[model samples]
Target: MSIANQIIKQFPDLLIKKDEPLSKYTYTKTGGQADIFIMPRTVSEAQAVVAFAASEAIALTILGNGSNLIVKDGGIRGIVMHLDLLHTIRREDTCIIAGSGAKLIEVSRFALSESLSGLEFACGIPGSIGGALYMNAGAYGGEISDVLNSATVLTRTGELLHLERDQLAAKYRHSTISEKDLIVLEAEFALTLTERQPIETKMAELTEARESKQPLEYPSCGSVFKRPPGHFAGKLIQDSGLQGKQIGGVQVSLKHAGFMVNVGGGTATDYLHLIEYVQQTVKEKFDVELETEVKIIGEDA
Candidate 1:
């Protein structure tokens, strides 16, 4: 039997789709299809999929929140798993317990509603809770590592682990979760009890700053490059006069040089080529190498 057939046989009630276009799920709205798409309703179902993929030697890819990611035109091989159904958020004392699939922005608002501080920096970050933890996502001088208390994850072998903040080894848009291939199921964030008005005010300020600067009106994978030491990627790109430069349907944001926005029907190939061009131009002009913060995956057309 084929792998898809076997998968159905093993998990009869699990939600699955074959050859589904990933463009429907991505922020950029430009991606190919997923070979075997699975959306697990519960952690157990997610665990089973992981275990089965491991045992069968089938490549498995997790589609977290679908931001800061680019899937190539040829689509992905093997199974693509999304945890959208696992989203749930609740409060426990001074801590907020959130499922992996919960939106980071929603979690930040939830904290504000509960009169909690510490998550104000994340009010505009567009990523799932798990994706935020995986990448140590941050903005405006605060990072996920700052408020995270602990997390529950699954190893490739399907072993469950409850790891503390230190175990994550989060630093500047990076985490051990990627290195260890751990699947984040849920997270606990330790926040401070504060006046609701202050939290709301802080969030408002940050939101204004983000909206005024970022190219929020376009379909773009947030910041395209990581900040190099002592130099901002956007500044360098702007200094190189590469802003508004176009490659196919993708162009460097006229508003923000760090972002590559799709003016119209942009493709992953276009984005990749534009990224290369920007990196090359910036390197030649400023002697600084631009490394991508956005994760690029899938096969080429």
Candidate 2:
């Protein structure tokens, strides 16, 4: 029997789908499909799936909230696991324990409700805790590395490990998780006790700033390019006169040059073309190399 068949037979209670359209799961609303998609509700179920894939030598992909990601037109092979059902948040005095699948926004709100101040910066980030940890996600002068105390992860070989902040080596939208190919199951963040009103005030200010600066109305993968050294990606793109540039249904957002928005029925190919065009244009004009912040995955069409 095939790996997919074996998975179904062994874990009949697990939700599994074949040839699932990945566009429905991504932020840009593009991509083809996944050979197998599994949604694991509990940590035990997630571990079992990981162990099965490891034993079978099948390719495994971990998907968080699908923000800051682009799936290719040809789709993903092997097993794609989504941990959306694992969303959970609990407070332990000054620290917050959040499941990998919990939305960062929700976690921030939970902190706010508990009079915690450290996570206010993440209130506007549109990703789950796991995804944020994977990329060391940051905004408005704050980053995940600032508060992350430790993470619980499962190795590719099915070994569960607890990694401290130093073990993560998170920096500038990069983390050791990708290099190690480990799956973050949960995270603990150290926070400070503060006045709820001030935390709420800061969150409000950040949310307003994001709303005013970002093209949130369109389907996009957030900022497409990372800040290049001393230069800002948006400023460089805007200076290069690439704003509002379009290829197929994808366009360099007029509202914010840093974003590549899906104007309509866009494809991953279109998104890639636009990215290349912008990169080439910016390099030719400013002589600075713009690196992508978005994580592109799966096979090409």
Provide TM-scores for the models: 0.99, 0.99
Error of 2 at 296 (Å): 0.2
lDDT of 2 by residue, 1-301 (tens): 9777888998999999999999999999999899999999999899999998999899999999998999999999999999888899999999999999999999999999999989988999999999999999999999999999999999988888999988989889988887787899999999999889999999999999999999999999999999999999999999999999999999999999999999998999999999999999999999999999999999998
Predicted structure with the largest lDDT when compared to the true one: 2
Candidate 1, residue 145: lDDT: 93
In the predicted model 1, the residue pairs found to clash are: none
lDDT of each: 0.93, 0.94
Model 1, position 117: C-alpha lDDT score: 91
